[model samples]
Structures are given as C-alpha cells and as structure tokens.
Target: MSKLAVQLYTVREEAGKDFIGTLEKIAALGYEGVEFAGFFDIPANVLKNQLDRLGLTPVGSHTSIEQLVDHLDEVITYNKTIGNSNIVCPWSEVKDEESLELLVAQLKKVVQRLQDEDMILLYHNHDHEFKKIGENYLLDLLFEKCEGLYAEVDTYWVHHAGVDVIEYLMKYKDRVKLIHLKDGIGNELKAIGEGTAPVKQVMELMQKWPIEWVIVENDEPSPTGLKDIERSMICIKNQF
Candidate 1:
C-alpha cells in the first residue's frame, strides 16, 4: 500500500532541459507522483496543466527558507495551484552548534507563516541534523519547537548518521507525513533501495507511519542511475 514517487531533484539534469518531457518519462517509468523543486521558468499554471495532463500529483517540494521568509504569499499561491499542500525546507547554511540554535529559531518563524497559509512545512534533513541543536538533536529540537513543522525523513541520512530508520520512524512517526525514499551506497550515494537503508524494514514500518508518499531520490548516483532506480522501484513494489 506504499505507492511511490520520485523527487525531481534526483533527475534535475533531465528536468532542466526537457521539463514536461522529463515528467512524461517519469510517468512512463511508473512513478505516480513527484516532489518538485522549481517550475524552470515555466508558468505555474502551465506546470500544473502538464502535471494534470499526465495524472501526476505533487507530493512535496524543496523550497528555500529565505523565499518562504520573503515571499510566503508566492510560495503558497503556487503550491495551491499545483495541487500540492507540502513545502519542504531542504537545507540551511547554518553550521556549528550555535548556528543551529539560531537556525531553528529562524525556521520556526518560517514554519509558522507557512501554517498560517494552511500548508504543511517539512524539514528535509541532511547528515548534519544528527548533531545537537539544543537539549536534543537538531532534528528533535526543530520538531519540538516548530509546532506545525514536520519531516520529510531521508532514510539514507538516518543510516548515514548511524541511526536506525525503524527506531527513528517509531519515535517520530507522527511528525513524519512524507519520506524521501533514497538509499545509500555503503559509503556512497546510489539509487533507492539499492544500498544500506534497511529498505525492507522501512517499507514494513509504513503501515504504522502511514506516509502519504515515498519519494525516491539520490544525492549523487552510480553511472547506471536509471536502471538502478527502476530496480529500486521494483524492490519497493514487491515489498507487499
């Protein structure tokens, strides 16, 4: 019952060139939805029309906190048009413990404004979130403070930080409504379900967390990216 999607950021090179055609190919590859990054200068309505034409749903998107800070109205306006209700803050420039504390406070404001507009704000974690932000880990602190905040848990990062995906999911399942289904490469980056995420276990836990969508992504990829992704999707589907 865990249907799949792809984060367009995983194949951003293809999207930068053929936007709509790339979406067509994604659909052909059996992805039911996508997590967006940008419109590539295509008007919001045009982008929405093409996605509708292809029956693709926007499960989430990687948006900047600064933009959410400066242009929240624009952010909510476009997402609503695209049939998406989730906005993800992908990364921040903050470094070190002190900076992380400040970042959390800054992002809480962004989360609050986003919620005021009736949109869910998600924090997309990197390996750094494992470092402490306050009394708890940065991930825990952000989730605790940003009342409306949620997570787009990236399985690989959980493992990268030496945390168990199942344990983390169990601990914060309520805060996680979506997930980035990216797999690891032992010590490298590869396609989803291809590396070291305990992917099978992660899939099994879905019944409890009840994710809306699992988005396949790879920060960097092996040369056989498409083939690997295809295989990963097959692995996910057969988990039932």
Candidate 2:
C-alpha cells in the first residue's frame, strides 16, 4: 500500500515559525512521511534526529532547478544526511517551445546526475503544464523529451487544467512515483475531501499502482494549516 505524506509547503507559515515543532505536530496527526519544501536553515543531522524520533520518513524534497544545476553536491549531501533520496523539481516555466526545450535539457542532465547517485528526480506539475503546443500537451512533450524523468502528478492542477485526472494519471502511469493528492474548486484550494478533485477515486487506484507516497497538499490552507491537514487525515483514514 502507498504511504501517506504531506508536502510541507502547505504549512509553510507554521513551519517557518517552528520547523521542528510543525514536524512533531505532523507526526502526531498520523502522517507517515513528509515532503519538505525548505529546511528553514536547520542542520541536516539535527533534522534527521528529530525525524527519527518522530518516526517520520523523509519522503522527498522540493528542490529548485538552480540548486540542482549549480549546487547539486550540497543538495545531495544535505538530503542524504536527512535520509531522503527523492528530489522533486516543484515547478518550471515552460511557456513555449523554446523554454520547453531549455528545461528538457537541464532536467535531462539533472536526472542523469541523480541516477548516478542512486537518487531519483521527479517533476511536479501545475495547470500550465497541460497547455498544448501544436499536437501534444506540454507535459507530454516534456516527459517524452526528457528520458528517465519521473512524475509527481498534482491532481488538483490536472483538474484545474480541464483534463480528466484519472486519464492523465493513466497516461503517465509508468512514470508516476509520487502523487500530490490535492483538491480545489476552480481556483480555490481546499482540504482533501472538502473539494471536488476525486480524492476517493484516487485513493481507490492507490492499491493498483506502485506509488511510493500519496502526499497531501493545500496551497492555501484555510482556518489553520494544522486544522486543514487534520481534517484531511480524518478523511484519508476513513477511506482505509
């Protein structure tokens, strides 16, 4: 079965105020793992020790393309120290064919480098990725051009793009390793089950796929970040 994790970007404010404390609360809320957005300047060893004590796995990290290109050694060392092997490129601008080709070249190199270190590079999607360039969706061309690049499909964005989320997932089934299980209505984000992004259906498919993690994310958390995720966890637990 796929494990549960939360993208820390959902609770960026809380994490900014108290990084370790926020992680402790996430652990208490029954999330098995965490996908980090930023380290908040915390030392990797100290962060690892806390994660170990809290019994939370380092699911992945959303790293910037610049860091991966210029300071990959530092990125690797820090993530390795924290026991994380999956490095995700959270977003990239692919406005046109020119930009698409540029990103593909950059990611190809990054992917190979990560492979050499036994780490995986995943690209997280947003609505823009669904925009078409002639016959193919930008996302399709991206994956096709950049061999060995894995996917971290964001369900909400797929829905926002007016694409059938399930169909999109099926299209990239072989390359999808992580899922950003999100929900929203139009442009507004919501806690998992509180919006219409086929949360239950995605959960149903979880058993059939070799997904590493189903990561919950709320780009704009309402009420409070903790409360939002707590409610999401309740809904997820009920599904099981």
Worst 10 residues of 2 by lDDT: 196-205
Best candidate according to TM-score: 2
**C-alpha TM-score for every candidate:** 0.92, 0.98
Off by over 4 Å in 1: 133-135
lDDT of 1 by residue, 1-240 (tens): 567888887777777888898889888889899998877888889989999999899898888878877887888898998888899999876556677678778778877777777888888988778886455777886677667788889888888888888888778877888877777766788665557667777776775555768788876755644555677777776764
Shift in Å, residue 107, candidate 2 = 0.8
The regions of model 2 sitting more than 4 angstroms off are none
In model 2, the Cα lDDT at residue 55 comes to 99
Clash counts per candidate, in order, are 0, 0
Evaluate all candidate structures by whole-model CA lDDT and list the values in order. 0.79, 0.93
Clash count in backbone of candidate 2: 0
